[model samples]
Target: MNKPSSCVRRALSLRPCAFAVLSLAAACAAHAEQPMQPLLLAQNARMPSLQDMVVTATRTEQPLSDLVADISIVDRETIEHSGATGVADLLARLPGVEITRNGGIGNATSMYLRGAETRFTAVYIDGVRVDSQSTGGAQWEQIPLAQIERIEVLRGPAAAVYGSDAIGGVIQLFTRKGEGAAAPYVGVGLGSQGTRKLEAGISGAIGADKALDYSLGLAHARSDGFDTKTSGAHNPDRDGYRSTSGNARLGYQINARHKLDATLLASRMNSGYDAFTYKPASPVDDRNLHRLHTAGLTWAAQWTEAYSTRVSVTDSASCYETTPSLYRTETSLRGYVWQNEYRLGAHRFSAALERREDRLDNPALTASGLAINQGRSQDALALGYGYSAGGHTVQVNLRHDDDSEFGGKGTGSVAYGYAIAPAWRVTASLGTAFRAPTLYQRFSEYGLPTLRPESGRNAELGLRYAEGRSTFSAVVYRNRVSNLIVFSAPGGCPSTFGCYASTARAQYEGLTLAASQQWAGVQWHGSIDIQNPRDLDTGKQLRRRAKHHATFGADTQVAGWTLGAEVQASGRRFENETNTQVLGGYTLVNLYASTRLARDYTLLARIDNLGDKAYELARTYATPGRTFYVGLKWAPQ
Candidate 1:
């Protein structure tokens, strides 16, 4: 049980010299060809052109521009104009993603990528696997965003093609099958401390080319206590919480290469704050109860013109209860996934296999009540090859993963692109990743079981520029991690072990910039991200990382009315993990308006934290000062 460390045996001895230097630099870059501009044909003509099909990359179904990893797609008008209320606030407004919240808004949420480790990302809805697996994270308030329609973010390290927590990257949530017209929509909101919210949805379609589509939605929200106690006393009205979620999907297309799909999802939540008490006089309310359910089945096969296959099966269950009882927990999981693809023209290949069986019921463990009932199986294999002559585009990937609970790992990546004319372009990537060891870090009987499995290496560079109606992008990244598993201080244990494993090594670097524009009809968007995330083996400074995050927004219409403004920023951070609790930087400004009183009604208003900054993202969790909200939305056709 203690033989998987030394950084996973030097990343499994550099995986056969990194797959022979990425197969000899992808066969000497296979004749490069990079000319394709006009802003990549206007970003592929602002997509939604809808004709070319075949997706689900890796597990078969190709042609989404013939994949080379690093994917992003968010539609439904960017999820209804991104006034997000879930899906982790729409993946915290994308662009290298990062979100961590423990205060305000539905509590516990975590997601991090590029700078990895929030159990190394990997969340899926329509493809099953919705985190957890005994605390590898992702409850995100049980996920509801009124049956999301699309979201895909693939970034990097897909555990050789999606298996074992994907080692940092992969988020897919596609729901909302089809149903063009049996509609009903509703909304309600009120903000600030005593905030309130309500939502409703309905959709229908059951046969014909509609091939079955269904949707149902409901939402509820509440808030109150803004915290203050130790003696400064003010606690009791601690925000209340409630939630309900539901989803269903069905698709069948027995022809053109067979297809079948089925899905069901459910959620329930109840909340009240304050847990984690190591006897500060032991009085913590924070009642909590959460439940989740999932069911899935999928099959896609296209065994000709280049072979393809995909199979899926999923069952998920989660339960968490807290009302003292030492914070009870329950989990059940079942998964089986299979994927295969084979193409031999310009060459492409993929393979994946996953099996998960988990059962854990806890009674504050010490091994009572089925402390852990583990079952893990993952076997992944991936191969990617791409080539385009003259102008330049090169890709090479290789992956391997074998785990029955941490055993065997391999990863490799390389990417390159060039098209330095017709509006510019550039891209570069290098990768390696690994993460495993979480069943509460290897069968927690109160932690420390010689845990290990956190590894990394990454590098990136990007740039894109366009013309006419403005567009721009910039990205830079660096990540380095090693054996990172922390939580020591019980005298750094090991007198025959009680706990001790904090010799952290971390380094995260970031820079992301974005720009957008549209003239006369007015629309402008902005983005900025800068991160440092330290701790190169004790130089300290990496807790709740945030060193400048920014966002700006604008929208305009002005005749039939539609105006907006948004500003978000976060800079100061450090809420413990021995950084001694800082948390300063803050900026939040929001304002929105919509009007169109007739054609089926619409009128909305929002003001939100317009400068009432008395922050605390977690030093006893404060957050939530200024607030306001007004709303009305209805669709009547």
Candidate 2:
């Protein structure tokens, strides 16, 4: 999307001042060893050289730079500085990610990755799957950013280890753990459109040796609508939400080779947002309330140096209630997973077995509602061998999965990375993945019942170059889908004409380029993604798929002051499967400034939507305009 005229003028007015400040900061960084000042401990540790290890890629703890996949890590520093209020906003800033929000805040959100459907991406919290089994997708607004410690995004298929709903990729979130000392903090902020927010949290250890860790957070937010209805009156424009979430983790070491960890998490939120359907009267308070609870236990043991096994059990439940009877439902999922790994030098083999039972009870029975109980049992076996010799690393993985609902599926992948020089590297990977049909897609007898699972394959190649303070990476990928599910008019229907289920083949190709540089106390980062996702048979672009998206930002530190600015651009996309309606693109900018007030306290201020441009992310649902907020954080030892 292009920036509006007013936004362009406003940005131009600030360019001269921003350039001057950047120049001065660059000069100072030249004399200092560290360019970007430490605004948060998490941010400081996110540098490639500072991180100790990561385990999200292979289900085994390993060094971050040693993995063969393209992954992105968002630490707490990135989360706090982005001025994002929820998980959806934070994830939308990543490469190859598109988010659709229904309204300004506390609204329904859907996410798509690499041209895949909303349900293709898998979500996990502490290694436990979090998506609803019936819907096969996640509601991003249900999870708040305040409770997350870090998020790791694996940008390709991971069904080899995660089982289902991982055809596009996998996003894993780790909750906060105890740090050095107990800390309590509170924050309050006010912004545009009558927006107001308050949050408080405390995190600490419970034992003498700090073996048990716990965190509790509570947040409340409210906002007024920015649109007026046809009745010449403002719609029930009041959007208010309150959430309480807490996490506890206890780790006990039975022996040097055995360890056990248990985790408990809960979140409850009451939110309101306008519905998308047309109504006769001014619609205000057409909202939904969401409640979620999750708990799990994991045990790890190393029988020998080359053999290890992990067993985990988790349960999660969600309930959604709306003002109207058509929007109420309750879904619950309980599952257990067991995994074993055997390592021998460059060869690692794994086997896993999982069973999940899902129950969807829709009491309202609104057209598409019915009581359904489904049991999905899966078994997976994989073999991966990686060898690094003479600056060249090659890895090959073969995986097979058997699901009760969709039968047996097999996939294979090969990934290779070669260090062309001391400062440059190139990597390439080709893999096959698939997404099984959700219960609602296959067993929703109320509307349609004839549907099949979607299957696809992907290939990606990337390049990375790093020298001193500059690093650049680029990736090009192509994905082809067979038996792609689509909504179309049924043939030879017994009833009236309406939407029905069908299958269509499609192909999607995209390129993503990202670069970040630190020079003279200034760090600049930018990324651009271009995609051509279309149906093979019809040669039509996929609905809600943006053709081009870009993000640019710069972070600077001068003395003890930190300043940052970001601009995000989303291109035009279709609003419906038929491509009958299109939504124009838009560009929005955000600015943040933070300073350390004392040894244990810091203050920050953020300005969002600096141009006050009116834009609609979804059909008839407008996003917020310019907003400003200031917050203070205190940490006591």
Candidate number of the best lDDT: 2
- Give Cα distance to truth, residue 37, candidate 2, Å: 12
Q: Stretches of candidate 1 above 4 Å error? A: 1-91, 95-118, 122-134, 138-154, 158-166, 170-191, 195-222, 225-321, 328-408, 426-432, 441-463, 466-469, 472-515, 518-523, 526-637
Q: Indicate the worst ten consecutive residues by lDDT in candidate 2.
A: 6-15
**Local distance difference test, per candidate?**
0.62, 0.67
**lDDT, candidate 1, at 216:** 66
True-structure RMSD, every candidate:
24.8, 7.9
Query: Cα deviation in Å at residue 538, candidate 1?
Result: 46
Residue 594 miss distance in model 2 (angstroms): 0.7
- Would you give me the overall lDDT of model 1? 0.62
Alpha-carbon deviation at 435 in model 2, angstroms: 1.3
Off by over 4 Å in 2: 1-52, 205-209, 225-236, 276-284, 364-370, 373-375, 446-450, 491-502
Q: Which candidate should be chosen as best, given TM-score against the real structure?
A: 2
